[model samples]
Target: MWEKNGIKKNKAQNYKCTDCKKQFQHEYLYWGADINIKRQIIKMLVHGSGVTDIAKVLSVSKGCVIRTLVKTGTQVNLKSSKKYYHKVQIDELHSFVGKKEKKVWTVRRAIIYAYDAETDEIIAVTAGKRSKKQVKDLFKRLNDLTIDWFCTDNWKAFKEVLPYERHLIGKQFTKTIEGVNTSLRNSCKRLNRRTTARAAPKFLKESL
Candidate 1:
């Protein structure tokens, strides 16, 4: 059944099974570098290797790595019954596109901060461009029915966009959203790099 290259080879002779009396020919099936390659890819991802880096090192396409990771990663339910965070902090930050070329414009970014009141655990983060319309859209998407206290800085945009549930504006209250920014920067090295934003936006969104 084994070949010189360690692959299974097709058998030349046919044989009959004793119990079933079925005639069949033995064939050799092979498992080659593909399995080993997948294992290596998973290992590199565990070691904090970026998808592009893994693709480059493995000489495989980025799509392959992404598909494998997505297939293997845990999937969570999107629908949430809980509406409105007890203490939600909201803020925006700028991420640039070009560096070496002098004419670089900043991307106004927004993030929704949700934390569990009792556990103080960060629950969710929604990021997008900064705009009053966008902020309002985010709140609509959140579908939070019960927000106890929504905190932000003196950003008129938030004031214009957010609903009248319970909003607070003051200095030092936007720290939670700032902390989310810090987490995003630390976790995604690609965002911190001074390169053009060439990576696929879909993949970047998924990675986030």
Candidate 2:
């Protein structure tokens, strides 16, 4: 519980997970952070602040910053479908993830995005491998949209999932989504090359 002066009024309750038997604090404010402070942390993160940078800015511990990010990242509504659109562009971005003593794991964690041509908006984003099944699943999420045309690279999945009449296979047609990929790589440290911010699949997925 919190008091009128914005300080904690009661001791945190401890609850154990049924399956894991792990004790965790059940606090009203996540990690004992004030609501305003949490919002400021989120804003800083969106504006390209690294975890350590955010921690320093807020005068908090690095672990606090990381916990806030993990809590906020996974809570996002990623699968919300948009309204109908006539023109859309789709593309995939592949990158490496995971690690081992002998060798690093070369995973095909592709970021599939759909860009609305007329409005210059990114309507959808599905992160997974560049496979036929995943591609079809992404389009299925956008089935409500009346897409008359789709611009994409010469990926065989596009040809297999969508009708040829509606699909335009060319790099020239997918400049916007490519730009988005570049922006993501530039803004996110984990997505950058040769960075210590690299993460495994689960952490990477949530971070992005």
Candidate 3:
């Protein structure tokens, strides 16, 4: 697709599935995202572009981008399952669903992530409601790592789930992961508090 003003959009082409006798677009290498829209969406996400900007430039609907991100994004894992780290930090970021009514935000969700502090590499990331179970699940994933220190904020779940000796709770030691929290808010529209681009839990989870 290309615009009348000579602005090129996606170079995507379509094909039919031989077995299913169905047509599909080749841009996303999957269904839904057509005309190379997936590539554009990914690039926009990397550059910290908001969802509205991405949809406008790529010539796709906001809903289309969100659905595509959730479908394909969830299938790919960022962290290698076999790798382990030494020192790590854990933190949570917040996002909300729906709109504020009567001067109140509803359906709040938390985006929790872990990172290797020494290497400054992310280990794990997920989105869910703020609860003890969320913290437990995140810690459980890091069980494979050869962890020495686990730094976090003064969240009570961190104290309960993590080993007393290994867990380190203080702002000083958690600067790196804290910065990541800021970066997440800056990069993704759903993570921004004041933005109209809210997200459902499934979409937030995959987006993270």
Best by TM-score: 3
Clashes of 1: 3
TM-scores for candidates 1 onward, in order: 0.48, 0.57, 0.63
Query: How well is each residue in 1-208 modelled by candidate 2, as lDDT tens digits?
Result: 3222223346555455666554444455443366567788888878877667777667777777767766774355444345667768898765443443333211324557788757777776665556898788778878777778888899889899988888888989888778877778678643444455543599776885
lDDT of 1: 0.58
What RMSD, rounded to one decimal, does every model reach?
12.1, 10.2, 10.8
Better of 2 and 3 by TM-score: 3
> What residue pairs are clashing in model 1?
83-144, 83-145, 84-144
Residues 1-208 of candidate 1 have per-residue lDDT tens digits of 3222222245444455666665444441322125566678778876657778888778887777766665544232235445555676666554454554532212224444445434445544445555677677556755645667777788788788776668888757766666666666555543343543465689786885
1-208, model 3: which lDDT tens digit per residue? Answer: 3222222245555466666655555346333346356777877777777667777667678777766556554465556444656668888876544454422211234667788766767787665667788888788777676788888999898899889998888999899887887777777665665765455689787885
Ten residues in sequence with the least summed lDDT for candidate 1: 1-10
Clash totals for all models, in order? Answer: 3, 0, 0
lDDT of 3 at 34: 61
Q: What is the Cα root-mean-square deviation between model 2 and the actual structure?
A: 10.2
